[model samples]
Target: MTTETPAPRHETDVTSGPGAVGAAVAAAREAQPWWAGIGFAGRKKALDAWRVLILRRADELVDVIRAETGKTADDARLEVILVADHLRWAAAHAGKVLGRRRVPSGLLMFNQSATVEYRPLGVVGVIGPWNYPAFIPIGPVSAALAAGNTVVLKPSELTPAVGQWLADTLAEAVDGPRVLRVVTGSGETGAALCRAAVDKISFTGSSATGRRVMAACAENLTPVVIEGGGKDAMIVAADADLDAAADAAVWAAMSNAGQTCVGLERVYVVSEVADRFLRLVGDRAAALRTGDRPDADLGPIVLPRQLEIIKAHVRDAVARGARVVLGGTESFTPPYVAPIVLADVPEDSVALTEETFGPVLVVNRVTCVDEAVDQVNASAYGLGASVYTGDRSQGRRIAGRLRAGMVSVNAVIAFAGIPALPFGGVGDSGFGRVHGPDGLREFTRTQAVTSQRFRPLMQPNSFGRAPGTMQTLVRMMRALYGR
Candidate 1:
């Protein structure tokens, strides 16, 4: 229902309404059967060719991403690289993960043979986010395509060019029907896709919007995988390496202008080392600069409305008595926002309770690591988190205690890069997974088949069984299960 148009000024306005979205889904549905019938080896070859095209034209894709999202060239390039890696991984692993496999028929059906396999859903709809536009959407798209489903991608209105570029390159790499298509518009376009007759929908955006998407999909009882907003946290222990922890905190908080869904929004440090850790973090955050310059460490805030939210969070924190360790409200200058670091922020402040989605970090001192864990788990979000400690065992123990779906020990956002790990969140952060084996299966429907090898000694399915047959079965069950 949003009316805002956030694309850059020079970009042409291109949008698709409900009619066009329906047409696209229809086309994809027609093409899906052929794509699936080709089998795993054939599909892998096509995907590999597409991967090569992505590598060869990575610079062009990077330019499109930067123009739409206002991210640095390096940041855009990293996103491209990660997307390609996921595409490659999906193409290589889909066969083993979703192919047919035999299973035991069990004692009750010993005379029958059983097998299970993952079959492609007819069509999948992907509604991607503007932040990390290429990387996030490609994860689901590639996995869906690998699992033999056609996809209709509805990119965020702010970043339609990037989505079109992906679809175009894929078409050029593989000569076939339009198995992948891009539909560009605002929330109306996205809602249309959700309500369409697609077999499944994969959505990445705010938790509030996610609820709406779920409601629309409910009309048809269609399935969905929602990856929503996050208020991620970082914990620095008393025995942690202060230098490493500070460095990780700064990069994770300030990078991408703090628009990352899994970025560090808060930090909890034990009081014993809070002073030292705060000093290191303040120094690193202060040194960072934001601008369009090639040497700048950060870029402008992409969405106009998000800028206001960032400003409000800082003002609320300061009004609530949080001490500004580095930049404050004055750091914001329209599109670009300098990194801001706050210490001893009130727990109830919006900066601490909400998803700031800006380059602001709130560091609070805790009495102990247990107290830190408690505070981190208090938030409604459970997307991702990090723990730093000199003792590896202690770090692991803390990681297990966090309520987030993904946790990194002595590292920041490390689980995202590994292709084998599932990515998603819990609570307001949303559910369902994308990446690894689970991701491959997300776009598939499980099919279990059984064949009767021979007739059973007892005809339990028959209506007229001999009286002695029932007594014999009872004795066998007692002999097998009685203790």
Candidate 2:
């Protein structure tokens, strides 16, 4: 979850029309053969070069991202840094992780030597979301490139310039049109890409849109990885650091105007510390200012349509008897929505049940850790959750019970910063992953091979079969089974 506030009302400058989608896929098709011809090591070298380039041009890239997405330049810098780290990690580890590895043959196949290798799945189609556009798109691109596949990426309509910038920067590292290309546009363009003859489709967006992408991919039987929406939660225990938990919760919930996927949308606190946690979190949230300034901790919503949705959620909660602890509704800030915090919100309210992708958080109080875990797991979305406790064992124990792809104990949304950790979710949150070892494998297919080392004296299926071979097989089965 990169940004959390509702988006501002602004016309998109570079959304791709339906006709342009066909042209982009047509271009990708033309570049397929050359991209596939590049062997694994060669592609790895190119990816390594791209990684270096991104790192060297990190500041400039961050500025572009911040300008496009309304995030602070410093926050954008962090995004670039993580993206560079992923590129470096994928390049360095691809050879070892995806390379051919020998496997032991069982006694029945003792004469054969076996091995497994991961190979690319031709051209890859990636449909990116507006939030963290560069980092999200780069994950699939890096892995696919490292495994020797061409890529055609379609970034969100909200931020096409950054998409163009990324494609232009990456083109310098790799030759040919098929290696890395950009197709900028709206949902139709994304749908067209999915329907094209691409071997795989990687999409990161809302769960509702993810379903549409998946349905389109089904037309070609193309495998897909959907990094969909998340309604993540944070658990505050009685023994938790009220100050730290409050700070983390406020920052996680309202940063980027609380538009992060794994950000703290809902917080569950023990009854003993509920008031203290609420006061602290409310104070911090109130102190935050959202605007188009460099000093502001929060930024305007990137998409204008998001504002209506944000308004609906807050209104629904208030109508259902939830108390607004802080800012609720502000007007005409050019896509900026002030941080809103709700307490005692009903469990079934839209703010609690569904994903409120704006800068609003619903706080609930639980009697115990079990109850907290239950509330956290009650939601259909389970991308991530955080637990704050001084006792490491208690934190782990509660974390173990929470059904989420990632968990942060005594921290908030730090999992994404660590390139080594797998970033994804289970159930409705989405399938597959986009970072760590899992991300690398998501773009590669496993190929297993076997070779005969020596001829057996008595082959199981041969011109001449010995009676003793059958006897030996029977004896082995009997010995193993002990029947």
Candidate 3:
């Protein structure tokens, strides 16, 4: 974890309470080995139980998210569904991925039978962001538990109520905070959780704070997985279904109040269809609304500081000669920042370079598909990318060139919803993956074993090795590698 100051955004002050965070950390540490001792089958049973509980009471869970984040009930429901999906996937696959499996011994050790297993890495600390708290935390929490490690999760202070709800529900299904537990607080609490006696830390938040979380975890030399902010891009090819592309781009950008890490922040459209795509995108953006109302398309920014940051990016872009194709130079409403789209923006504008994290999109025009791919790849953050095209080969080519962790062709942000796909970013967008089999192994440590079933015919361990033994070994090596 770096000592550098974190970028200003929304955070909580929950760490200051009397022994609140300390007790949470102590309890989690105390219960660590107990959870780890449960073996894979035991842990899976607990996870499955919790999954059923969550599925049965999903509406209540969504209601908690709705109260804390102010997102629509539907959005909250989606979060619950994502969590349930991950829990179910982890439960169903944990055994197959982590169980000890036999492997063929290499030629050098042909007398021995080998097996490889993924073992628990003890306790895991999960520091979650307010946005998609349920889904984000569980991506790590469920996998960690399924991998047979205890977890201590610190939910964002802005949404402590949701954290409490998760803790309560898990407690009912699992035993004594062994499998899953939650701690509520601001950065200090999260930092404390990082420094707690844990083998690894998982965080989902801004890159700046992610740096801080990494630094804190480094104090214990603990490994970390960060799902940080992204300046994701969506490409619109000339042959694309303009209406579908436009709708997806708008929805991806504006969903979750544009607070999604993989939200469509930048759009690159080929000049041949730029005008038509622009009109469609603008129409979709114009029809969007931001507020606390249930019927509204989106909700307010979770943190006031986030609103300031969004406003600053928009202001900086406008000053740098960018035209606001949609809402721009918006009035402050304390929480809600209206969705905005900027066009003809300079490449160096903050709206294009930095993560606005508000309901904003910066659309750029490219002369050809090559230019479109180049523009989409020209960013420090590469979490996710989407290319809309009728040509399958062209879409795959564009996706291959974009330096992102995940890419979707003819879809906006659909890769994340797929349980089989790995999720994480490269560069400053953060590293490591969650979801799919990759995610299942992220929380596990590989343990290799070799058991000698019989005495070797050519006893290399003995000093009485005959010259014929060397000849035999050489023959074995040659036979294996010659092909």
Candidate 4:
């Protein structure tokens, strides 16, 4: 077994205590109304400006992300691209999705005009994860800001610098009260943020940690949006393009050192194509390289603790009669983990059941698409999945049967890039969404307004109503709906 030290702490890292966290929340609460008062158009203008600033400083942001997480430059660049896209989407769509809209008052209440609108929730607390720190936190932060709520972010201790960089850049883009704040520390700081009086909290991490966040928020009866862990699966139909499926499997399973919540951890391929698919996946995974060098395909594992989990899962699978096609426990070299592909891993093995959160893939054979779907749904997590087939309709059909929040047909992790689609999961994967229209509304609450435009023909609300008023109303109801 290879031993690895914990992530190195940086001198520039800021540790926020409870006092500091409380003060940040208080400041956000005080600044929310003014932020909201600017309205959607004004907010959009500011966000657009910020977007430009981010684009101009894209290289710098990428450098900071890569330095903190030890991910490849390409991966870090992808984060910057996604952050800008989500910011633009949230700023542009918030008004249309949350603005007040008129509703029909119905036959009996035609004199009253009714409207419904979503208003900001004042302040939101965001607890970010270490992996994909910038992209993940921006999902909640952009939506919260676009919805007019200031944000207080508590990034993972391992990657505090990335979170602070985001806050500093936003401040440079917009000259006013701090709409986004960063409070850095360990789990205790996150717990404190959850306990604070923020209007809502958006947390992204493991399911185990998410439960604790929920418990903490329960004390204040605060609402929360949890984006937890996922053992996302991919289905390979017999008719699927083996080359395409294999390529996607390799990329999804190994990218970002497989630290993605929506990454492919399990693959269920039909028996007819299992051997060919496995061979292709092994060949491709074997060619990938890992290091901090510019030519490297992937970087070292960001968290030291995760390295052990990856090793345990791989070893348990091998011990349980799984076939190691490419890499195994020997792939461990402290901090850096090479891609490992296992075949026929037992259903009960931790490799198949738990979130390894590393560059490891479990391939299992099934008799048909039905069996593949069953095995995919059998897991406790339901975050994301993909289906590959020659027939688009068949792929769609298989995707519908799988139990997950997002499904990509003939593609991998495509839903995350689209600004209009909501991103989230089910079961142990956690609840609530944070991406598109639903994401914008996640930071706001609905308010219904009704105004009396004119007096009704019958004063049904009055006790001294005229005789036969009830009969007239009954007749009208019968005419409208009792058909």
Query: Which has the greatest TM-score?
Result: 4
In the predicted model 4, the residue pairs found to clash are: none
Residue range 293-313, candidate 1, lDDT tens digits = 988889988888888888999
In model 2, the runs with Cα more than 4 Å from the true position are 1-16, 20-23, 26-38, 175-178, 330-334, 481-483
- Estimate, for each residue in 1-483, the C-alpha lDDT of model 2 and write its tens digit: 322223322565555655676677667667766766766677767777878888888888988788778887766876788788888888788778888899999878889999999887778888887778788788888877776777888887777777888787778867766467777655677888888868899888888888888899999899999888899999999999999999998888887677777778999999999998999988998888778775887877777767777888888998999998987765335578888899999888888877777788888899998898989888888899999998979998889999999999999988888776778898788999877778878888899999999997668786578868888887887898867
| Candidate 1, pairs of clashing residues | none
Candidate 2 Cα deviation (angstroms), residue 67: 2.8
Our model 2 lands, by Cα RMSD against the true structure, at 2.7
Residue-pair clashes per prediction, in order, are 0, 14, 4, 0
Global lDDT of each model? 0.91, 0.81, 0.82, 0.90
Q: Estimate, for each residue in 1-483, the C-alpha lDDT of model 4 and write its tens digit.
A: 111224345656466756689899999888888999999998999999999999999999998888788899899999999999999999999999999999999888899999999999999999988889899999999999999999999988778888998998888998789999999876878889999978999999988889988999999999999888899999998889999999999999999999899999999999989999999999999999987577888788887788889999999999999999988988988789999999999999999888999999999999989988999999999999999999999888888898999999999999999989999999999999999999999999999999999988898988999999989999989998998
Give candidate 1 regions above 4 Å deviation.
Answer: 1-9
Q: If scored against the real structure, what TM-score would every candidate get?
A: 0.97, 0.93, 0.93, 0.98
Prediction 1 global C-alpha lDDT: 0.91
**lDDT, residue 91, candidate 1:** 95
Ordered from best to worst TM-score, the candidate numbers read 4, 1, 2, 3
